[model samples]
Target: MAVVIRTANWHSERSAIRSIRDAVFVREQKVPADLEWDTLEESARHFLVFKDGEAIGTGRLTADGKIGRLALIKSARGLGYGAKLLETICEHAQTLGHQRVYLHAQQQAQGFYSRAGFIVKGDIFSEANIPHIRMVRDLDFSSG
Candidate 1:
């Protein structure tokens, strides 16, 4: 099972990205429409994952060089797509010369982010009516 992670601007791939976000964040988790989207979307790098030529998942890297909106479809979970998405985001970050990357991860998914090399920091917070926490990853590979 090979996972392909690619990034494109909103206009080039808005529909596929929207479908993933809506399925994971809106209809599945009941995240309100207002909270599910933000101004960053327009300028962010939206990544999509395709398996066997079918769009399977998506995540976004913000204009300010942040990665947070990572949501894969339910059926796609546990298949390594999530980690591949994170890898894609980090690669984009490197291309933009951002060494520090952070995300507001939903509390329940903290372990997932942790396994992807994000270190949990600070206390829990709320986003879209769900508990979340701040996580950061330093991409300065030369240090370690």
Candidate 2:
């Protein structure tokens, strides 16, 4: 699988980004449309993962160092693509001079993020009607 990660422009790539998010969050997870689409898109740096030239996953890093809206189509999960996408986001955050990055991870996905160096920071809460927890990972700028 030739998987490639690319930085996407929100204006030109909104449809591609929305397709993955829609399939994973809206349709599969049943998250409400209103809550899934937020005002943050305009300012967030988006990423799209393509496997063999086909868009399969997406993620974002916000201006304030929050990573969110991570999603992958059902066909793309459990293959390490998510981790690669996340690392790409974190790398971008570091390049932007952020000392650390945080995210509100769905409860079930905590273990995934934990394995990638994020630690649970606080109590559980609800977002988009689903249980989530705050997770944070400090950026290491010691290396290239």
What's the TM-score of every candidate structure?
0.93, 0.97
Candidate 1 structure lDDT: 0.84
Per-residue lDDT of model 1, residues 24-93, tens digit only? 8999999998888888888787888988777888888886667877887888899777887898888789
lDDT per residue, candidate 2, 42-132, as tens digits? 9899999999999999999998999999998888899999999999999899998999999999999999999999999999999888999
What is the lDDT of every predicted structure here?
A: 0.84, 0.94
Model 2 per-residue lDDT at 123? 100
Model 2: lowest-lDDT 10 consecutive positions: 135-144
The segments of candidate 1 whose C-alpha lies over 4 angstroms from its true place after superposition are 142-144
